[model samples]
Target: MSPVRQWHDGLQRYGLVVALVALILLLSILSPAFLTVSNLVNVLRQVAVNAILAMGMTVVIIKGGIDLSVGSLLALCGAIAAGLASAGFPVPLSMAIGLVLAVMAGGAQGLLIAYAGLPPFIVTLAGLTVFRGLTLVYTNGSPITGLPDTFLVLGAGELLGIPAPIWVMAMFFASTHFLLRWTALGRALYAIGGNEEAARLSGVPVMRVKVFAYAFSGLASGLAALVLTGRLNSAQPTAGSGFELDAIAATVVGGASLAGGRGNAWGTVLGALIIGILNNGMNLLNVSSFYQLIVKGLVILGALLFDQLVVRRK
Candidate 1:
């Protein structure tokens, strides 16, 4: 590749990292509290939920699909888990059931999109509303409380001086990284994303892969719900509202093509960290929450523009 092409590729690949480093530096200079160890750890903890969601989104998007229901699924799963625990179910069993339900929900959507010839966007958008309604109905528009101490540990406890959420994020990211980089299933997803018809003709098991992508997304949302519920020591029916946007933004900022066939677990994590830093820094600087939303919207637009430029160059 020419130097110019290499530079463009680097921008697509390392842009999020550069942005993150620059943001950290700017924030460190602007706010003394930003560089503190406690605050840094807090940032990681805050990003963990979105990072998990974005990793799953990465898989779906790379398969030429999306999952807008992730945020709602998170709420539903958390509420279910909390409700089960409150009703005397074992913490493990409660969590297991919540995850199972989430996966089933996602798989159902995937089957529709893959086999029933439904549009992914429409299916998941409908799911977004359905799951949110289910969450509200399940919790009667209230928060479930009185969760077990062990359940709380998954979100708030520290292991080896690192927050449990961070640990969980790290483990998930590592495993996902391996899957995307070294596994045949990962390659199949990329192929499907690049060209579904071609992938199917090539015997890539396109439908199965699509289903797996959606199922993985649900699994990630379930894990995020666990951490979120634990952190709050309760599950709010309204939780995770608008969280899907953050996950999508993270995936895009991490260099994932919105059109599909691109993205990495590490990139998605970095993107989430960038978002976490932005939110934390803005809060520390007393920036208006409304303005923060505007800023995030602009970031998403910028990422898309960058993706377009790279695509045109290619």
Candidate 2:
């Protein structure tokens, strides 16, 4: 490869690492607590949900699609799980039902897009509204609480002195990394997103890949719901409001293309951590919520600007 190509590849692969190091340095300068193990673990716990969602989002984006319904899907799943558990259902059974519902919701959206020829944006947008309404209807806008400790343990319990959510995130990431890097299915997803017409011509099974992406998005949301409900010990109809944005922001900041076909699980994970640290730092330093909003917007803008610069240079 040419020198410039090598540099570009390196940036694409390790940009998240560089961004993370810079963020830690910046936050440590702002507060010594930022470097403490406890604070760092806290940030990881906070970002765990977003990171999980973003990894799912990465698959869809890699296949040149988007899933706007994930936030609502998460809320719906959490509500379902909480309601079932409260009614004395076995915790495992409740979780199973939640997973099934999530898969069905996502599969419906994928069917609309792939078979009915609906646009992904439109289908998932409809999903966003429908799932939100379903959540409210299911819970009657009331939060469900007092979940079984078994379910809660998955979300709030610890293993080896580390938070359970962190361990879940780590295992999921490792599996996803292997799936994307070593599987034929993973390569097909990239090919489809990189160029659908070409991928089809090359016999990449575009429809199957697209469907899998959406279904996986649902699965991720369901898993996220498990942790979220456990952490709060309640399930609110609006629990995941705006979570979709966080997942999207993390993917983009980690250099995933809004245009698709160029991102990774590890990069998305780092992006979530960067965002978590930034939010934690702002809260710690007593920054006004208004300023925090402005800062976040500016940071997203910076990432987009960096994307544009990289593309132009290429």
Best by TM-score: 1
Provide the clashing-pair count of each candidate structure: 0, 0
The 10-residue segment with the lowest total lDDT in model 2: 254-263
Candidate 1 displacement at residue 113 in angstroms = 0.5
In lDDT terms, which candidate is top?
A: 1
Residue-level lDDT of model 1, residues 220-246, one tens digit each, is: 999999999999999999999999999
Give TM per candidate.
Answer: 0.98, 0.96
CA shift of 221, model 2, Å: 0.3
Model 1 TM-score on a 0 to 1 scale: 0.98
Each model's lDDT: 0.93, 0.88
- How many clashing residue pairs are found in candidate 2? 0
